[model samples]
Target: MLAQIRSIDSNFGRTNGGLNQNLDSLPENEINVKLSGKTKYTDYKIISHKNDTTIVDTTLTIQKEYKFNFLRKDNFELLAFHNQGQTFNNLAYDFTNISQFPDIGFKAKLFNYFDIEDVNYYQVPTPTTEIMYRTGLEQGQVVDALFTTNFSKRFNLAIAYKGLRSLGAYRRSLASTGNFRVSFKYETPKGQYAIRGHAVNQDFFNQENGGLTATSLEAFVNDDPNFSGNRGRMDINLNDAENTFDAKRLYFEHTFKLLSSKDSLQEREFSNLKLGHSFIRDSKFYRFNQGTATTDIFGDANSSGSINNKTSYLLYNNQLFIDFNSKYVLGRFRVKSDLSTYSYGYENLQNNTVGITKNKLKGDAVSFGADWNGRIGNFYVNASGSITPGIGRLSGNRLFGEAFYKKDSVLTIKGRVGISNKSPNFNFLLHQSTYNDYNWENNFAQIGTHTLGGVIESKWGNISVDITNINNYTYFNENSKPVQFSGDVNYLKAKVSKEFILGKFALDNTLMYQKVASGNSVFRVPEFVTRNTLYYTDEWFKGKPLLVQIGATFKYFSKYNANAYNPLLAEFTLQNDTEIGYPTVDLFFNARVRRTRIYFKADNISSFALDKNYFSAPNYPYRDFVIRFGVVWNWFI
Candidate 1:
């Protein structure tokens, strides 16, 4: 089957290849008779913003199971709420994957937002379609569908949409979201000119009940007999509150080769010089609505009748770069310059008695950067840095570098270091809301961060460790106000993963350890987190037409101070009164038929047997025992 095409170099989804490798076991005639004669999996390519290419993977493995969720990614470091499309409590943080500039800061809603890197372009030998469907919390379902086709050998087009709607078990806990994307890529036959672009629109809506009330939380935590059967009767803090977030973006990049070698077969010290340009326009809106304000919970509000607040952010960016190759540089180097214009704020100026007067923050920034990629035998070096001039909100500097050593396909090692200095998110700098306690304007210094990390991947196991130090860290305190820490924060994180197989049974384990060397009062995380899965795999029937996998996963974490979700601000705030930690068990049965994979899961089965003390946050109870079914299907035409 064409579905069995495999890429030569693959680590999960990220791949690199200039050559194609076929499945030798398949008969020669079977492969030649396929459409386009491109039967290898590598022929179906997915390209990232950085132009890294990976093939569509149809194999069913334990890693695949971990990624089968609403996010469609492994959420090992996140604790999900009771329903999908809702906010998550962070279990860990990665300082290395930070943006160079500040952004519109409704972080809780950004989880479902698709960034430039999250969007992918595709090239396939035939028209290909993928559909993912899954059951939701109570009253809805989720469907993500994508279709791509190639009109010619050098041009491709793709469209995708993911939508979800669910009415959760808790009162007023309903979530609905939709994301739409269209992407295309084109190249000239001579490999001298190429272009790629994409357009995306996404919207998120959630009905917020503000979690359970004090009595309700006590009853749920104590497993009171009256509330044991039905959680709907529990009292909540808010009855008619909801929030929505919407975003739209358009992006394009084009490149042209100014000079090239005449001979394709001959190796040269200096070969190619290319010029490229990229442009992006993005806009975002966030709105909160409530029928009535909860004065006791959120303090006094400007208007007691109802609350309606909205914030808008707009950005335009243009970048130009030149790339060249030379023997002195070893591989390739790119030097670039960028100009960006941004605006973030509310519609009307707020001149309250509290002295918060600004309606918006608008400015333009100019930055210059360079990137280098070099290889010496099996060792590779990649480094990049950028600096923005002037004392504007977006003015900052960032430097990152990584070195990799690969020993055949058996083992690989990588080391990385990063340093960044940037202002906090826009919301921290200036925000205006109907609630008196929510309005703020402050002049804060740029936050500085430094991170050092290393990773080793091999057949025996996988290990990664990172140490990060931060100065002028910013956070929302228990009072729900943005505040910068006066002290430095140092953190260390380490993770190890391994899988042991014995015949048809396998046991996979992942363990993570985290520590706050300082600044624990403001920065908090659990000391230990773990997930272990034990599964049995086998083929069924005489022809082995079906492959089956049955497994149970055990996950747990130590008790620590977890942040609380605030629907009004679409953010998480510090909470020290309640410590949250729990263990959960999930059972799954999966099967693969042709290019389709089916999934059935019993989530949080431990809730039916253990104490009812599990909480996703301070007052948000974890999901109870629920059975969910889903399927992922891919078809090639």
Candidate 2:
């Protein structure tokens, strides 16, 4: 009885579940359920049997007046969605598709490995489901689905699936991909321990038509003005080639408090001594197959090597970290150790009469790393470094640091610098293509790169600049053979995005300028690229219940000798002959009604009307002028 009196006297006693039995049970036993439906009604004055005035109300009449820009998806990350410098079906902002293969690099040759953008999984209390469907070029279609739910406040699970199938607009061009992911997050009620994990499997199958034949490309450019209209009739270099990239991965990270925070009961803070462990097991397979083998097209085709080539890679990694975070200047610090084993290359061949041993690699490496990050007032800084100790030939060493300052949403700035010295992909060192067009065994030195970049953003717009220097930049030359540049190459790139809104009209523009300060002979980049949009927005009706927006986008890039793509190698190779550049125009109208959004767009509106050249990749023409319609509906069920 005395305890009850003490608890009742305090306002927080209701939440303490102390001696108040009735209050404690009542709070926990109550359940919440909700549902909603809407309808709209119109009233007419009977003057000429037409409605004169319109009024919208939430209680009496539901209004379908929600409105949004049709080009909302093209707002900021437009560069990525555009895939400006890549082949069709490729991701954007991936102009440089070249990177050192992972230490355990075994996978089917890939053109879009660096292009895939993984999902950002989140843990939430409410259940969420999102479904999207889209049409492709010809017989293409995209379907996506994701679902996340929390069984308890401290635990949640999520699953996501995606399927893409595109027959493409050209002959013998097609792609089919399936991606599945499952993830879970858990935390202790006391917030002392937590774990997050995800497992993903992706299968990408692409038909390698080897693009169109040279004569066909010539006809497309000069001989035939309406070539794009009959894209299905174009002659291709190789029609039987197909590449499949398959991968599976499992990752998990868990952290447990080593020392409890002093305010653990009253409040929770991540600042404390903690121990963490992470594990990863990943594998990849890449295979290229051709039904009718032809040695004539690819030099080594008929030479005892069937037109089937495959590669596989496996990796197992484990990491441990001891971390400390404190409010007192120590901010946060982490000491980490990693051990990984990798196996790559072909295990067995269907036929290897070439008298060559199976090109294979297997190794183990151990690395040590440390990192620190802290925030002081309006400024924040972070730094990290790692080094490998004679575990494998690959030098897994890296150093990076960055600082950021932000006063409010209006003024924000960030600068970062980093360098990585790493070995080339094992596949790059010893590659065997069943097709004779490409075959090599390179003994190249490890490459290193230094990068300095900064970004500034404000209410007006944002700007970013970067400077990069690469020693021994690796790339495929005109000969379709992988080569490393001996000298250092320097590149400077800057991008700016500015938007002006006056009354109901708005204009947005983004421009990128790139320069090769040195080693122009080896490095390549366009001089300039830009995208601009002009739009107007307004609302109608007495209640302004209906909103509408219409806009048009313009994209342009300077003419340059864009790299040619080799389907067999899944690589973009240097080409000096053809320079591709042209301006593209698109018009769009988008609207939101209630919670639903609909968009209509006409891409490449001036295609045949203009002789401008538009190609996603060499010999691969861009999509012709076409109109598309799409809708997005969100449900909170």
Candidate 3:
């Protein structure tokens, strides 16, 4: 008989375009296998678009995914898995632009492990898991091919072609990446030597124009015929009215390492050294053409336009490290120290013909750091610090230290503190030029700032808090004048979590609070949110597995000055002062059967509606009462 159960998992519930939850688990000495598949239906309607009256039609989407996996296996074992997903929207708009040409990609891996005896080793397992190991060389390959019509538009289309070879795993062994690399090592009685190299290339392109809004003569008048001399004639003449862009990147790297060790009566230790260098270059071009003009409410005339921008960037980096370990007092007390240095330089250039703007940015930086760890009796301490100097330096100096004490099985205490400085990026300093007659600039008064935080943990539970400030601790001049702003412009956060078990049932709870102080009246921190969940597992129907879980979340936002920026509205100056309604609550339930899992989730179960404080794009609406149901399955061979 096969066990089938309903399982519920916790998630942040924040839709940020990435996987919703962390899936990595500690290594175990068990052969676990899973196979699952799922299909889902989604209905989306644009409720409001920044006060716009143009109602976006409703659309429905259908999607599916399949996956499989095998874990913690011995030598000669095999694990294989694949995922396929498709989405269909009613708007005649292939959600994935299959007509414009889309592509399918896959990756696979196979490895054999061997153990060496008669070799002395020191192992330190992680507190969360009993596994003690480091990542090393692993071999794999990836292949991708796109169909010509995958992303086809009515007037244009695009296709992608690429392949990659991979070798050697990094700290997070299972992470997906596109670099092919090799490593070699030589050892002797006196010391050890090692070298490594990596190279990778990727290319992509797409052309889409069908379904675009019609262009008008007013938009054509703003077009720049002589945008750039280096651009090909075809690029300059392309309609590009549909806002399209394509890009590609290539990377290469090389590294070296050497170590030495010896034994003595007072202390026995090993000193290891490592060095690495890498060079990379990237280029990208995007074009957006406007073919129409639209009028706005305030009698302001807005014309449709297109833009083409290209940028090329290059980077060089070097790193060196040394490690030393020693023991004294009959091998009771142990000490370990490590030091590293890194330096990097980068240059970038961006050219835009639509705005007739050419921008160049260059910067170089260097950083050095050292860490020391000591263990005496049942107490252990670790300390580290680093300083970085550079033109666009985001972080100048950073220091972190931690201490942990364990007294048998009775209790354990752990604490850590850290402080650091940061600098702003080029985009924050350089303004964008959209139209020939339109120019905007960032009015930032500060270059960078600092942050400090600490954490404490014990068997009972764990708690952490951090505070960060930008421009409050430092000051800089903009446009030959000292700029000043109101508000502390700082952020504070705290979190705590613990787990409990009751017979066959398990419960976990976590609490978090965050607040951001200072900033322009138009920008404010999101409301405070809290979530709770309960889970139960039981055997049913002759040992068939059964699990059920349910959860709920609540969000509260204090009425603040909603009209702080409006010159005509003086009644409300702060968000907290506004007369807002009650908080919102959401509920969800999930179940699983072997490799198959299902989810039933609802957002804003109370049917509450509110405007979002932030906007990623114009004419985008915020929605409430979003209900979703999904299922997934996996298979392995």
- For lDDT, the strongest prediction is 1
Residue-wise C-alpha lDDT for candidate 1, range 283-388, written one tens digit per residue:
9999989898888878878776888889999999999998876655576778899999999998896436567878999999999999886778778777889999
Error of 2 at 471 (Å): 0.2
TM-score of 1: 0.95
> Sorted by TM-score, highest first, which candidate order results?
1, 2, 3
Clashing pairs in 2: 66-592, 108-285, 108-286, 299-436
Better of 2 and 3 by lDDT: 2
Per-prediction TM-score to the true structure, in the order listed: 0.95, 0.82, 0.49
Number of clashes recorded per candidate: 3, 4, 41
Tens digits of per-residue lDDT, candidate 3, 399-505, equal 66566665643455665555545443233333233333222223344333344555555557767666665553221222211133444556666667665668755
TM-score-better candidate, 1 vs 3: 1
Whole-structure CA lDDT of model 1? 0.86
Question: Against the true structure, whose TM-score is highest?
Answer: 1
Better of 1 and 2 by lDDT: 1
